[model samples]
Target: MSGTPATALDFPGEVVTQAHVRYVALPGVAGPLALVTLDNGLDHTRPSTFGPAGLRSLLAAADEIEAHTPAVSAVAVTGKPFIFSVGADLAFRSSLRDPEAARAGIHAIGELGHAALRRIGEGHFGGRKVPTFALVNGAAMGGGLEVALHCDYRALSSDVTALALPEVFLGLLPGWGGTQLLPNLVGADRAVTIAIENPLNQNRMLRAAQAFALGLADVLLEPADFLEEALRWAARVIRGEIDPAAARAPVRRGAVWA
Candidate 1:
């Protein structure tokens, strides 16, 4: 896949959006899996935030992964150490002056994010429908959580400190499929708590344990070898060694109290 031109969009700050891809072969697994890591050059302090250029970069990476020869059996997306992503680049939005310009910019951002996420959700890479997973290693709020929700399955690290849809606190909503996908995954009441009620109540964030109880994560692993564990879990699911229904049954009861 061709890279997005540098002139395509002017992003704020020195954010260098990039996707690092690698293939991993799991024991007893039939085929190699594609693993994509999202990064923004900055350390965990900056957190990966999506802007127009950043979204385009992700799209390019997805395209490239889809075109891989021999066809991967599945795909997994993860983030840098101690961070999944904070969400959209609010700094970029803060730069707009005119209302019309701001509206158009916001619309464009939502469209780009949705399109790329939809492709991942449907596993529509290179004319195939492979299973997709999200390994949320740390904080994942707003658009970041939406990205995770788009995946077929998600795993979380016990070290994760924050998870929520805080757009409502900022006088906005999760316009990038969060409202729809969240309710479908975790039920309407909990979706309201995470996307609305909690945001209104000082933007409360869910700890990793809370998220697991809410059924947002299929598996929770210790930070030590978190990715390796998540990869193994994905392979087990793909190979029919683990039952997704059984895995979710225990969490479904926990969501009642979450």
Candidate 2:
């Protein structure tokens, strides 16, 4: 679905997820790395989610990263302590009564997510072709997992137990690029298992090891120092010490994927 650029929407009692940007200097990596932390200002019990306001917040963070003076060499997006994000705010969608309005809202939301995330995968940060990383330190479901898929590389924490595109189980689809990007990443067969089969079969989610085995994550890290290890790995990759594409599965396209 497509629509005009998304504008922030107001909803009662919305727990707005805020994107906080901090620049980190990783050893052996040139220039500063823009690290975005997604938080909703609540405990882990309440996972961060993307509503209109939250999506706007991420767009604003992207703006900040683009506007940095020295120009960020790399970008990384992560979540709070044990939660990245759980995707769009279902509470906001459930409150809508008009079908037309719901359709418009869904389109707007999907458009916003695409706008905010596509740049990372495309290396379009202020016209500089820099790599992006998704340091998945915790649970990443639905749109959250889609966010990781948009990055050049993903580092998943071993402690993560919930990672899936459960939208099918909820009678919805992964409208925000999951359907297309996932199949391209892990092959159509594995992507079907993630986007369709597992969700249909009791909404099964992937632990970090399972996701790694399925080629969803480029690296699996321990939770105790996931952030640090991820940074080191990124530095190594940046310095030509590690080759990310070497570890990835061969790309399948044309009739092979079909």
Candidate 3:
């Protein structure tokens, strides 16, 4: 139809997801902790979704943080009030008419997402590789879950009721690193269960406890003080008070994975 809408901003009327960065002073953490908040400039009703424009916004935010003066010791990403993100904007997917156009759009979005999110894990900022944490404080689905997987560590909120990778159910694969990252984080079998099995079986989603048990997150905190607790937990991890490897021992051990 419309030549397969160009950028995620192709839809003139759609709201653009914005990545906002701010430095938070952690009590024990040495340098400033750069916190990136994803918001579509909307209320909780509209969960943030990454489109090309959104992905570009995120990259710019990372650029800003990396260029800061004093340099940051750690980096963390989180969502708005009640939502982290639901993944790629389905509106972009639904608008494509031509198969070739859809293919091109998907490729463009995938590349942008990879370039934007991978920096967190690569730890390329402030002349050294600082640690990264995904502070998942609310609902996260599809690409949202994948974004968390990009972080070196994930801190989830106990009140999160919906967490999933439902791409297969949506007639798409988890192209934006979910397929690879999920398997590596939780092992192959469990990754199959999450990335394929659950999506096939009625698009089942994971609750906070279920995801925590599955080893998707490093720690889970109460919702009442979710952000604060997540920050504190991140500080502990950065300060070496908490060992992520030890936290994931149960998952890495042969019992559950086997």
Candidate 4:
């Protein structure tokens, strides 16, 4: 459990993929909020790159989170180093030993992530009665971006941290609710524009202000104040100082799908 898997190469300062997930409860004014940290310990790509095994581990990790979360009002730790998540591991996926197996595996993993997305975004977890937040300290692309969008609100870094959906370049669409989630967070126009545009041509990097303006990001803070800001924001909601219910905006129907 303390070492890397035999199938993986030995690398220094790398995030081991075995049990590469963890969860904890945050002490809030109302009750403890669940805080799950995704730790593929990846120096290159995300755990979503590992195919079926990775998907299984991710679902199992969510189960672990539920075990601790008998109560609601959860927030993800997008605030730490290697914070948030970096989408799928394209490098590793392209290197699959068997293309057929890899394709099937990617489909399965996408399904798993989509289900998890419904839980987080639709409020299935935390009783669907509590607000969830994703404190995105770093970049979140593809599935990672969808994860952040699954929450009611997002706290992003003021740095060059990006939030993108680049699934089109893969000869695939966003299967992990990214297409659905992005529109919900940002407006249909921006979301559809992003999806329609070629990711290979766009950087998709959003500064805190840009993220805030687009409504995809709720608040922006310096790296130093990021965690404090998120906690404070969540605490306010817990304390009845702010209206969390007024936060969500329905995704407008757009030309792409309809």
Specify the highest-lDDT model's number. 2
lDDT tens digits by residue: candidate 1, 9-58: 46656375577788898888766788988898878888998887778777
Residues 63-104 of candidate 4 have per-residue lDDT tens digits of 555555455555454523644665655554555568886675
CA deviation > 4 Å runs, candidate 3: 1-9, 250-258
Better of 3 and 4 by TM-score: 3
User: Ranking by lDDT, best first?
Assistant: 2, 3, 1, 4
Please say which candidate is ahead in TM-score: 2 or 4.
2
Task: Provide the lDDT at 254 for model 1.
Answer: 52
Alpha-carbon TM-score of each model against the true structure: 0.91, 0.95, 0.91, 0.75
Tell me the lDDT of model 1 at 71: 78
- After superposition, the stretches of candidate 4 with alpha carbons farther than 4 Å from their true spots are 1-28, 42-54, 97-99, 125-128, 198-204, 244-258
Q: Which model, 1 or 3, shows the larger TM-score?
A: 3
lDDT of 2: 0.87
- Give the TM-score (vs. native) of candidate 3: 0.91
Kindly give the stretch of ten consecutive residues in candidate 4 with the minimal lDDT sum. 1-10
lDDT of 1 at 51: 80
